[model samples]
Target: MFYMSSGNDIPIDPDGSSSPIPDIDLSSILGNTLLIGIAIVVIAAPVVGFMAWEPVEEGNVKVVKKWGAASGTVFEPGAHFINPVSQSTVSLSTRPQAYTMSSQQGDGNRENTDDAITVLTEDGLRVDIDITIRYRVDSAEAVNFYKNYRGTDAAEQRLIRPSIRSVLRTEAGRLPVTEIYTGEGQTKLKAAAQETLQQDFNEDGLILETVQIRNVNLPQEYAQSVEQKEITKQRKQQKENELEVEKLEADRKRIEAEGQAEANRILSESLDQNVLTEKYIEKLNETDTVYIPVGGEGYPQFVRNIEGGSGQNSGQNTAQSTNSGSTNQSAA
Candidate 1:
């Protein structure tokens, strides 16, 4: 028997008849190899691309570092092509974050603890303060923030929390315990603390949004003392108000009396002798009887008609005689 080699046209036999074996086609094998290679590449291309691409979500930025050094480029929210073997990306959230320290539970981003801050006031009294700070990595300076703290989460632990504690301690120390317990003074302290912390955060490439003093715990004895003082003060104010009301009443009464006296004085000054005589005559004309004072100033000497009897005849005679006497007196 004869057998043909697949690589060449030579025929060889080990046993049996001489029948030619078909030569194997090298082109087909090569074509099949090329197709397999192409298929492998097609499958592996996506895998390589998937490994090299980095996706940055919204509200976040990715900092790419190449060869252990920053590439000085930040990728915004989109698909970014990067060399996975030689370069890597660090994704950081540019959104606002909160760091809260309080005795009560807070939102998910808070550090709830019973360990309130104890600070000595300027007057040497102790005060416990619970505070919350809202902050964020400056989006424009996210790379710098990353360089300083190496990460956004790290910025909170290393930069924000410690700075807040330090600023709070310093600002609280400047105020008296009495003032610290008051609303106005607490507001001032919060402002001062916020300013200080903002400055500190700015230095570390972070933005300080707000600083809130959640609660302030005062000594029991001091709180009671303040309560008593407030009670006494309110009582004193009440008494003062009552006295003011009384004073106003007295002033009103005095003014009314003075007005009445002035009215009486003016009336008295206006009534003269002639005015009185005219008033008396006007009253005499309204009745059938007349009375005359005998010997007083501004009074007639006698009364002629004294009764309601039929004095018409006598009255006419007397009136005629009186008319003649009045005419003679006028002529004289």
Candidate 2:
């Protein structure tokens, strides 16, 4: 037996009469839209199969996990073909990231407000600190990191956050609030936190880049006290500076007085009796009168000019006798 096709005959049975079954058109029964939809899906199946190929972004590494666990397969940045069903990628960023503990809203990885680190100093004053730690996942050991911590978020939440607070608090408790507030001591605190956190991050396949102690906020009472103390210290320094200036002035005055006394002593030593007499004689030459009232010998004798050429010094009157031919000196 055989069946008749549109253009040929097809055999069905060997010793029976041929029966032709009616072939209903699938497009007529299911409609053209459904048929077109089936054809599109059939054609697009191979293209959609490319979902196995995952593209990684820059500064990131993708860890392909099998089942629910890490498969030790890591993919670097760019397109990679991965199994769609059993295998998937967990992207881990190798770029620098920061975990900041701050008081300001939305300033850190956290969403809640006022998440700054609060701890006590050696002096027992409560301190709230704002700090930021920079680090990156070591891509080489990313598999091992995921094996232990499962993911980057879990690693950060479990290890890095707690380690930062622990190391910072431990270091801070060693110093008093005054030292921890600023200056070289504050620098030391940052260094200590960085060192310890570095080790902790290294153990978890994370590279610690930097640790920044942005702000150290002390209690209000302590801040006010410190301000008052600073004010007093400034006043004390001002007073000391004034005293130093006064001491320097006194030293200068003393030096001037000593110089003046030395000058007077030298002048007195230079002037002997002969020097005094010479100075007094020299002084008499500049005057209008030719004779002095007092003589050098302390006697009251007046002497006119020896050279009579100066008319002012020489007197017009000469000694005269009243009687003629009498050789006598007259006295007035």
Highest lDDT scorer: 2
Q: What lDDT tens digits, residue by residue, belong to model 1 across residues 1-332?
A: 45555885556557644456789999999999999999999999999899898999998898889987767789989888999789998888878877777655543255454656678888989888877788777767777877788886787778766776777788888888878878887797789878887788878778888888888888889888988999999999999999999999999999999999999999999987667767876775575445556333322333232322335654564566456556655755
- 69-146 in candidate 2: lDDT tens per residue? 888888999888877878888888899988888988798778778988888899887898889988889999888787
Winning model by TM-score? 1
Every model's TM-score: 0.68, 0.60
lDDT of each: 0.76, 0.77
Candidate 1 has an lDDT of 0.76
**Model 1 RMSD vs true structure:** 8.3
Q: Give stretches of model 2 more than 4 Å off.
A: 1-49, 239-332
True-structure Cα RMSD, model 2:
10.7
